[model samples]
Target chain A: MNGYAGKILRINLSDHTYKTEELDKDKALKYIGGRGLGSRIMAEEVPPTVDAFDPENKVIIATGPLTGTPTPAGGRYMVVTKSPLTGTIASSNSGGFWGSELKFAGYDLLILEGKSPKPVNIFIEDDKITFKDAAHVWGKIVSETTSILAEEAPDKAKILCIGPGGENLSKISAVMNDINRAAGRSGVGAVVGSKNLKAIVVKGSSKPTIADSEKLKEVVKESRGKLKDNGVTGQGLPTYGTAVLVNIINEGGVFPTNNFQTTYFDKAENISGEHLAENFLIKRESCFACPIACGRYTKADEVEGGGPEYETIWAFGAACGVDDMKSVIKANFWCNEMGLDTISAGVTIAAAMELYQRGKITDADIDDGLSLKWGAGESLVEWVKKMGRRDGLIGDKMAEGSYRMATHFGMPEVAMAVKKQELPAYDPRGIRGQGLQYATSNRGGCHVRGYLISPEILGLPQKLDRFAIDGKAEWVKIFQDLTAFIDSAGLCLFTSFAIDGEGYANLTNAVLGTDFTQEDILEAGDRIWNLERDYNLKAGIDPSQDTLPKRLLKDPIPDGPSKGNVTRLEEMLPKYYEIRGWSEKGIPKAETLEKLGV
Target chain B: MKIKVRLFATLRENRGKELELSLQDKATPEDVIQELEIAKSDVAILLVNGRDGDFSQELRESDVVSIFPPVGGG
Candidate 1:
């Protein structure tokens, strides 16, 4: 039982049949767990040519060896599948109690397959499993669905469900858990909807057993102390949540505002972390044994959900040109309740706002008789609600995401995205390495897959000039590999800022008895990255698709520290290709593949 | 010239507020800290014109320099 539940739960929705399979030690060791395991399973079981919404499409939810353990910030889980939005391999990891609960439920992984004829909800209680009719809960919002399920099940049950946005098959849907945490990005919720699965509720009292309990506890204590003493984790994140990045990124001239037309927001101060804390923060919440407690509990009259994080704040506040804290908080709450990705929703709405400003979209398109304008908080909130409900033409187009919306309006270049997924807070043009990560990311323009921002923006490990492109290619590849290890380990990426690869390796080695060295951990990360890249390549994505939008390439930062600068992707791309042991066309070399045993 | 500077996050929250700093003529970052009543251990990054500045980097007159504590980041 050490490091795993030693069982896999398989649920077939079409026949309403459920079964349990033994966990393979070989697969677990090779992939580690979480996103790495999900990627491997999806790549092998589901064909590359299969459509993301097809009946054969499978969704894999996995937790790592450390999940449900006492390791600090170890309560993360990953949802992996072919994404309806990006049309690529998608793996979105989320922080919540659900992963821990799932592990405690006597399953290391949950695999869902086949489409159901009708809606259904799955419940797991340790070794017991039940599939019940979810006809009444199918169309409910995330909050109501979760509340109803929790009431029906045990008090301690953890629920992961979607809302009307997902039921409507909205392209930007997210699966919400713990009422606030979301496995958000690349239409994972739509995949859930495609399977006609309503929700998954789990309750378990089983305790996870570790190989070396004494050694594991020591590592956990040391790691937690490091996180608490670290300046960024101890102070910045806990106090302001991720919203702290607003001011920092703005100063770097990378906080894209007004649909990537501007990098700086004059009114950014009004919607920043400092402002959010000063006005709205009610308390702090933690996931499992996390010491950071970056989750915000806000009590503003207009916003009754988790406070807008940095990405959400940037998406709704700066990108849409609406700097009001109340409006940002309200949008955050509405996105969660409606099961929409706040990052994608905000960027898509911002693109629509730009289209409206340019006379490409008429006022007649908006059902509420609203005039979408830059910095109009009221109009922004109105449109967010309409989009959630899919009310009218504007809502319909907005619900499709920015890439499709841009194509529908005949201005695809203005979408401000990579591979259909909208860009997050950091402007790639300002941070060149992030541009490479976004363009080359398996799931479109995601930051977490390989966050070079740690070095490019914050200078955590070693300070580097944000404006320069020197050694960034090597730096990005290293970060991407290390990040893969963290994601697979089910540990929060935030901890990596303070703890190095050796520290993370020790944590894994202590708990799982894997004897992972720092080099072995990084090599595993590299292998996982290559494996995902291979999957995406097999899915018809090639080197040509691994390119940034024209706007980021051509446009220069208008002001601030990075003024008169554009991303030198031309220089970095070749170097990045070389460092990854890939061909000039970005395909992994045979020797490199053999070395990693991919 | 002398000025009042405030630190933030770990540095400000842990250590007491408001550092009185004295600068030499045509002073840079090195000159300001050398003559100031501030601890070097508490300062991680220097913010001149609200942007990151090197400790050895030069400073100009009327620069609103903010000193931040040695904080880690994501």
Candidate 2:
């Protein structure tokens, strides 16, 4: 139990009872931890087809072996559950002090089962646990809820909670922690809300035991040196934060604009990171144990808070056809306050704008007096508040996400989503490998699942022809499998800029005192990937769902540097299936499952 | 020939955001950066006419050249 807390806390809300179970060491090694362990537990305990909001559905909050340790950027955790948004197995990752605090509380995992008859908050100090009434903070916004809970809990305790978006059961809601950091995808927050649980406050006084302290110290120093020497992790992120990518992506002509109808924004400079640093950025922030410090704290008019990350900026800025940086900052602040996924909320608004443009949504249909016109900054800010509150007819529909909202307007094709989950900032038409990654991502339309953008756009490892089809399937498989490893190990994906498979193996070996080679690390990743894929398949997410939006596949980008390009997914799907050791129909082969023992 | 040159991130500190450069016929992106007094190692991403470009690639009149220092994030 060198790298683990050696215990699992299972809480049954209906009975207001809890049990501490011994950790299974073998399973922890096999699945790594965090997302992998949580997903494995869900696969065994929760039925694949169970409704996401049903009392039977379980929420697993898990931390990896490296979590709360001295490893660089080790403060991370995963929230795994059935997704109400995509109806696929969902595992969302987040960073802050919360994961480390949970580890110190003497549990590797916290499993919430059954529904509470009333709103409640769970508090843990060391091994002590208590359940308290949460009537005062049940429907509050995230910052307010955190403030109230912090006052009631032990001093310096970390709190995780949902906001109005989750309380109203918005399918695009996020679980916010440390006030701003979020496990922000696949509607995991709504699952938390469904149980009538308001928050979890934890404070602890111990550290995770390490097997080889000397080895860990050397590896940590080496890793930290690599991060310091690397141009990206060392300087760029520290200086500009993630918002630096805004101008780079826009210049690449793959910055999605107006909900992907166009590939470029003419006034991108207005919303660029360079401009943010010059005008609105108040400070650079960092999560626990992070050296890159890519988090940004910005202020616009009156609001000040953490982030408007590149994706958030693109979502509310160019994608919605609004170039006002101040409005984008305000929208991001509201997203954190309301516990909404900024990407989904903003893209859903963009889809609604398209619906309005096509006359599917008339002014009469929107009684809230907010215009659906592109670049309507005031409307963007107000609609986010309404979507979080689920106010009015349009707000209620938008709360369900873009695909459902567009389908309600009789045109699901306009949503710009894959598997009913909204796509991120990049337009896949221009980046072929990313297109395949989006289509095949187990969690649906998420960039962090694979992040082909590193090699394809940022040229981290090597640059490939973004439009080329040759060997892209192979690249996708490698990136996806490696990403799975990083997520399970509780490391930030940005660390991949400096660390490779061998480096990850070294870190794991040093932490757990296990002699795992690079090949073993990747094999573990492959196993995790296939397990999630198998779970989704069993849950009725068919192989046909492995596809991009129809617009990306057929219609070419109308204008931009990447104009006249479309995702050639057809040419790569079979190759990807072949590379994954799956059948032609995209089903995992029996041999593959046996080989990985998934 | 005249080319539009764009600088971003740290590269834009002393230099401006954008500039118009005049070069001899058959000037390449290398020449454009040289005209701007930018070190070759300082440029991590180079784009000519919105496509990935090499330092030695010949530039055409009215082509746009974009340059950035080592920077990345999703």
Candidate 3:
């Protein structure tokens, strides 16, 4: 109770009824918070056999103990539910002021259940909660929805809303906040939309009380100073944002280009962070108390929005073969406005382009006669809007995401996805461990949950050859579990680049008043990972689903520094299973579950 | 041989601004740092022709070298 708001607000959309539940200290201790808490609740409450879009499924928005506290990068939250895309437990953490505001509203988590008969939005102010009719705002874009809510609620409110994409139940839809920030993966927005829930607006006046306020202030001050002193956080990120990785990853021969067919891109420099900093960036932004301020507020021509970060740049630029910076930024803005996951949207479009090029599909197949061409930014933006509105054949096919889209085209392998979700920026063939991570990730092909690229590419902690398969399994397991802890702590994983596990442990201890050691934190992270895996397992996922795409496993990188390298996933996966205390088939062993108390 | 040496992020700030360093043939990355009067500890990543290189990595003529200070990362 010292760190938590000590309440969970449950809204049953079925009957338009709402109730508040006292926070359980036992659950908090076991699950910690954020993705951890959300996963635990979903596992215990929702049946594994339930369809993700069914009325029985629950969507949980959760904040950690550190969130809303005077801690650096504490303005974070997680959206967890069974994914309509992957049919697995989907937990996507996002950064914005919403999580902190929710914490300020005296609630640790918001759990929405059952399908509503009519569109509605939930508003929470301190201890007061209201369900408002969302008929007028139901079909609005994310930006418009937020604007309307802000006008109605004034400066005190923060809204997390979806756009037409979510209303149509597009599998790649996202929940957007602060206009551009998103809980952007795994179709959590679609699940919310399926329930006829439009958004959750929160305004809180209560300030959190800590047991050792002085100690927490000191720790926060020190942490902020450390972040400011660090080069990546203090300078690189603030100046260029994550788009800086375009050149770096391209140089490493791991930047996904043309839908993972190649590693390097000749036009990478055109979309590099330097290009963004030089052309578009007008200012830098930060989430509550964060010093890094990697958020880019930029303008280009007539378009103005949060400029595409590294992932979005790669997704729209290199992955889709469009190198025009303005076009990529435009695409990013469109996706944000439409409330689509840029990664999935870009990858799905990339797949469509490939199919078009291979004569698998044609412009005639599209309702608007839109051409699917690589580097065709205009058409790409048009398709993005179409997908959001479900306007045409291409839009309808793409709304289902790459896997289903590819299947419809009679070539499922062209999807470049693992377990239905498309891969992010990294080309797994060039980074062997990342392939394993993507293949085995509980959320289906997500990189953030456990970014091994820190060690494999950036050489944080220690340097490992990006092209090597040696000892990668242990590295992946270590990073995966530790990253799970960071995600649950409501802290950005970016801080781990310079800050060690001890730094995070210290912050957690200061915020929660829990004596958490580095080992204890790692164990907690492992427990969260196992819990997610268990959820996926019960959801019918097995070892077969935990495998990389054939292209990454069989086809080698055609050129560049990593030429001839294919992901040696087989070499690392068995060892990875052993390290995770799982069986040979990647199932969490009973002993492992017992050890983690899951 | 003259090569374009660009300092970025923290390194640029630490070194006052972006710098263009001229070096002799077969000069190592360390020599460029010395020429720029940058502390060895200030350089976190050294890129020669857009690939990771160490201080001992010899620079070639016309190499577009980029040196960055340690930045907090993900």
Candidate 4:
């Protein structure tokens, strides 16, 4: 049980019953932890045929072996369940002190099943687990819920709570941990809300055991040095935050603007990381055990202490043709408190704006007296709030996510999503491999699933030609596999820029007393990835779903270095399928499955 | 020839955030960096008028030159 809590808390809300099971050492060895373990248990326990909101569908909050340990960027935790949005196995991750606190509470994972007849919240203190009535806090915003819980809970308590968006089962809702950090995307929050679970409070006074603490300390010290030496993790991110990508992505000719109609945002600099640093940033924040501290705490007009990453900036700023950073910051604050996923909520609003502009919808279709203009930050913020509250017909339509929203308006192509999930900030045409990653990602359109932008734009691990499809399939496969391992290992993917696979392997060996090689870690990633895909396939996700939106396929970027370049996804996909050991239909072959032992 | 130059990330740490530079005729982005006293090796990507540009590419009047250090985030 070295580097593990050696317990799994399983709660069944159907009968108000709970049980603790010993951590299965063999299964832990096979799947590693975090995403890997969570996916394995989900596939085995929950059938794909079950609806995401079904009482049988389980939501698992899992921590990895390195979680709460001294490893750099070790604060991450994952929420895994069948997604209401994509109907696929979803693993949404978040960072703060919660995961570490959960580990300190002496459990590696918590699995919740069934829906309570009344709203309830779970509290964990050391070995004690209590279920309290959540009626008073059920309708509150995320931060408000946590504050209310603090009146009775200990001062050291950390909370993961759902706001009104999740309580109402909005498809774009997110689970907020530590008031701000989100286990965002894939509608994981709605699943929690469906079970009448308002929040999970954790307090622990003990640390998990580690096998080789001295070696772990030494390895972490060395890796921490590497993170400090690297330019991105060391200085740029800590100073400007992830929003720094505004100017860089725009300059690289890949910053998606106006709902992916173009690759450039003319006023990108106005909302750039430099702009945030110069005008809004009051201070920078860091997650537990993280050295980079890329979190931004800033003020936009009257709203202070709202921090936004790059994706939030794009989703609220340039993606909708809004150039006002203050409004974007204000919108971001609302999304966080209301437990909304900024990417899906903002991008859905962007699609709505496009429909409005194209004469597809008019004032009659929208709120009376509210003009849904491209740069109407005020209206955009209003729509986000409405969507969170599911206020009216318009808000109800928006709660269905971008895909269903566009379909209701008779324009599914403008959704800019894959498998019903909205795309993140990076447009595929500019970053060629990113398109493939978005289409083929297990949890739907996501950048972290496989961030090729690292090599294509940031020049990490050596720069590649952005325009070329050559070596891109190989590159995508490599990045996807690497990212899968990083996500599973409970380390932030940012660590990949400084510490390579070898560094991670060494760190894992020192902490967990495992002798896994770099190749072993990568193979584990491939295995976990295939497991998630297999679950999605069983859930009826068509292999054909592994493709990009037509906008990226048919329309050439109007102007940029990527101009005239449509994503050569077809040219690269077959090669990627070949490399991934999947058939033409994107299913894992028997040999591949046998090799991975999944 | 004169162009507005914007520095980003680590490059901005060494010098000012932005500058409007006056360069000799046929001066490349490399010449602009040299004028700023920045080592050519420090720049990872350079953009002229918001498109990818080479250090050796000749600059023109009113061109917008943007330079950045290596940065990675998602």
Candidate 1 chain B weakest ten by summed lDDT: B9-18
TM-scores, all candidates, are 0.95, 0.99, 0.95, 0.97
Q: Assess candidate 2 and give its TM-score to the true structure.
A: 0.99
Recovered native contacts, candidate 4: 0.54
For model 1, the superposed segments whose C-alpha errors exceed 4 Å read B1-24, B30-38, B62-66, B70-74
Q: Which lDDT value does model 4 have at A18?
A: 90
Model 3, range A1-598, lDDT digits (tens) per residue?
Answer: 7778899999899998888999898878678888898889998899987899999999999998888988788888999999999989998888889999999999888999999899998888887888889998989988888888888784769989988899999999998887889999998889999999998899998866787788887877878787777666776677678878776677767887888888889888788787788778888888876778888888878988875778888888998898898888888999998899999999999999899888889767866656778887767778889888888778988999999999998999998888899889988887788888998898898888778877777666776777788788888888888888888888888877667788888888776788888888888889999998888888898778888889999998899767888888888889989989999888889999999899
Kindly report which residue stretches of model 4 are placed more than 4 angstroms away from their true locations once superposed.
B1-4, B9-22, B49-52, B57-63
* DockQ leaderboard ranking: 2, 4, 1, 3
Candidate maximizing lDDT: 2
Superposition error at A344 for model 2 (Å): 0.5
Give the per-residue lDDT of model 3 (tens digit) for B1-74: 77877665445555643456677788998898888888887776676765667889878878777776654233
Q: Candidate 3 chain A — worst ten consecutive residues by lDDT sum?
A: A363-372
Give the proportion of true interface contacts each model preserves, from 0 to 1.
0.22, 0.71, 0.24, 0.54
Model 4 per-residue lDDT tens digits across residues A321-384? 9999988998899899889999998898889888888877778877645657888887766787
Candidate 1 residue A10 C-alpha distance from true site, Å = 0.7
Across B1-74, the per-residue lDDT of candidate 4 in tens digits comes to: 78899898667766887899888899999889888888876777777876668889888899989888755586
DockQ for every prediction shown: 0.34, 0.82, 0.32, 0.57
| Candidate 1 lDDT by residue in tens digits, A476-506 | 8888899998999888988987789889988
Per residue, candidate 2 scores C-alpha lDDT tens digits across A60-113 of 999999899899999999999999999999999999999999999998999999
**lDDT score for residue A150 of model 1:** 89
The i-RMS of every model, in angstroms, reads 2.9, 0.8, 3.0, 2.0
